[model samples]
Target chain A: MQRPVPRRSGGGLARGIPAVLSVVSAFVIWEIYVRVSGISPLMLPAPSRVLDQMVQNRVLLWDNTVPTLKATFAGFALSLTVAFGLSIILDFMPRVRRALFPIFVVSQTLPLVAIAPLVVLWFGFDLTPKVLLVALVTFFPMLVALVDGYASTDPEIEDLMRSMGATRDQIFRAARFPSAMPYFFAGLRISITYAVVAAIFAEYVGARAGLGIVILNAKNSFRPDIVLAAVVISSLLTLILFSATALLQRTVLRWRDVEGHR
Target chain B: MTALSLKDVSVTFGDIPVLDRINLHVEQGEFVSILGPSGAGKSTIFRLLTGALPLQTGTISCASPENSFAFMPQRDALMPWRRIIDNLTLGLEVQGIPRKDARAHVAPLLRDFGLADFTTHYPAQLSGGMRQRAALLRTIVQGRSIQLLDEPFGALDALTRTQMQTWFEDRWRAARWTSLLVTHDVREAVALSDRIYVLSRRPARVIAEITVPIPRPRLGRPPSAQAHDIEAHLLEILLHQTGEKP
Candidate 1:
């Protein structure tokens, strides 16, 4: 007897309703808090003022945002490539994986904030530091995802492929690599959110131009309106990148179960 | 022609002895089954033959060309991300056949496998029976002369298992590729196998091997009375292997 898998109806959009509502309500409450508190704009500018600053300083915001975006994209690309290459190599060389995996874990313990300054000190106030820091921070999660994904491969499938006269590389291509796709995408979602934040922090340490610089200047000048405006813009950038990754996962792994699509 | 033979073969896993000795043969185009209770080390034999496990002591001789044997594990083992057609063509594609050529090669057989309309569907979208059928097609599509199936329908419910046995019987009769099946189902063994090897429990050895004299299509399609007798005989031995009263 085939037991029908119980599926939640109305699709992913239905499930996402509460999240949308919570965000909207949070924004509305923020707008009200600013209006009623009558706080100093320096201490707490009204959400409306923040919105107005976003528009008023759009040109300035855009120029700074471009550099941060460039750093994020560049860093994310470098991180993903490095992670993929390393995961594949480690998967092939078990001796190397066993030796290096503990070192990688130890490396994660080195504080990103402390390392950011050192990276800047070494590379100077330019794009290089930002890119290296972002890649340094983001590559680990994807690498972990890939290593765990390779491990998650069903041993039966490996045996099946081996029985077919497939080479080690062929077994990986047909079974192990495809088996890791879901995990890899999950790692991508997590890493993409970190991309913008890491870029901003790196720039905060040192940069010629970026959102981090703009936010620091605004904070120094007591322009909370501009600072909050930059915060909103940076958040929006992270949100957009995250959503794109999710969309790409849905497209690439559309063959997965309906429940996974959500 | 003798396509495969295992002579004085025995397997042990570290301290555990799984197969004491197994001497079996599968002639060209013959359908044979190795039957026993669960954990009878039936699969160990296949694993040894496929080089998945080291042969502790004994010899396995097979003159079948490289890539001439397809081994199907118990689970469907389909790549969840691949479409049904891609999953079916996995063996061929991995053997250096390009995807387009593999797809083309299996296209005509999809209709026979009842998966023509499911080319684009994923494994999760298909029913359990359909997925198992797809897996079987994947095995057959390897174009292998010898196919090793390890309890292919063991996970199915009773009714589906019965139906699949009948369906598999029809397909096997049509092509009659040299196949060695490992199953614990007595009726299944009686219905499908030309000759059967009954194995004892862990540290298993071939206790008995019987040739079915019952006629063809001895399944849901009104199997002969003799088929029932053979099933009963096999079931009793299998139950006895597990030290149970039959």
Candidate 2:
């Protein structure tokens, strides 16, 4: 952990301080606005009240958080599997890609409110509906990223490989797959965020547990503080998942980041 | 002995004739170049050889067909994710050599290519000339005698191009591999090739074959008058084909 850091990533302290300050100052301003305006906690909770609600219901929050995280991870993994399978098939068969890409795009345009409850109705409201909804929302980005990545390789490199007696599979392994990695990571970064939000939305459609249920319950009961607390937890989860994706990309694609400048 | 020979090769792209009954041959331990204007189907001939494009009509025979040619493309085409060593050894790996063994085979040559210290560095870490050197090294380390280069250093700046050309000319003198270079650069063809084949523009046909009688280490001395005369003649033939200046 104490290893000498390259200037690019090592300047994180300089880069992060302003963002941290901006967020902190936003919360401070919110706290002051609530105090000065004397807002009713039911209508709009103070930051302090939300913090207290979070602490008081910590056990309940933790229990609900487990289910949300479970749904997110399960759904995200399914998305990755299906997307990878489709992208590879599309890579090999352009006809298949041409036939299916339009359908994939049209799937993204489907209204989630119209679709999520139907998925719940069909899959019966357990972990299955949640995972299906997440996969439906998240798989497209990863799939497109992978397809584009595979196609992005220079044709000259393919010829070079062939002249050296490389088979199609060999060309893919040596050139296409490695070339596609950066795009794949970019897709993962996008899809992971969608997975987290989609998980919460899955619960809102009809799940028995999760932060979405907590928020919905609190909203009905006029406990804005509880609603805001749940919102904060979900946001934090999204941030963590996004950061983890970034870290994974930096580690696996180390060659791109060598010498810091590139 | 003849290393590779092409007989009556002709290509037409959907009835637009690209190459027309071209006949050429390369001898073992010789540096040969095909000089043509940009779209004279010089690349079409290469594409046919590499099997990127189907052979419309041709008989290409190699003395040792089992040995694959080390082909260097104009783009350098270095895999960015791979370190210079891994990139240089990629051809060996393609030929079914294990990665560790390939690395061992290329380790001794990296230094001579000016990439010894940079072997473990990624391609993005190297300069344009260095990356081209690494690409050339990758081509040679396959242990193949025939090298097909399509303007391998054409992307570099003038100074770097000259340096690489000089370095490559010296290497060709030492090793004497059977090579076929495809280029539109007249001076480059005259500088490095033992013999140059000039091709006419579209519907390309072999117009002339000129042998360089200049002495070795061609770049070692101020290019002799004979080398310049050959270059001017080749340029005149190429210009006549392009209808640019004759």
Worst 10 residues of 1 chain A by lDDT: A1-10
Judged by whole-model lDDT over C-alpha atoms, candidate 2 comes out at: 0.87
Runs off by more than 4 Å, candidate 2: A1-6, A259-262, B244-246
TM-score of 1: 0.94
How displaced is residue A151 in candidate 2, in Å? 1.0
lDDT of 2 by residue, A117-226 (tens): 89989998688999888889999999999999999988878888998889988998899988899899989988888887899988988989999899889888989999
Tell me the tens digit of each residue's lDDT in model 2 across B1-246: 998899999999886998999999999898999999997889887777766777778788888878547788998888888878888888889889888898989988877788888877777777889889988888888888688899887899999899989998888887887899999999899999889999998899999999997888888579889988998898888777788542
> Which lDDT tens digits does candidate 1 get at residues A61-141?
999999999999999999999999999999999999999999888877899878999999999998999998889878999
lDDT of 1 by residue, B41-134 (tens): 9998888877788777888888664655799889988878788888998988877789899999999888877889888877887787888999
Off by over 4 Å in 1: A1-17, A257-261, B244-246
* TM values, all candidates: 0.94, 0.96
DockQ (Cα-based) for each candidate:
0.52, 0.52
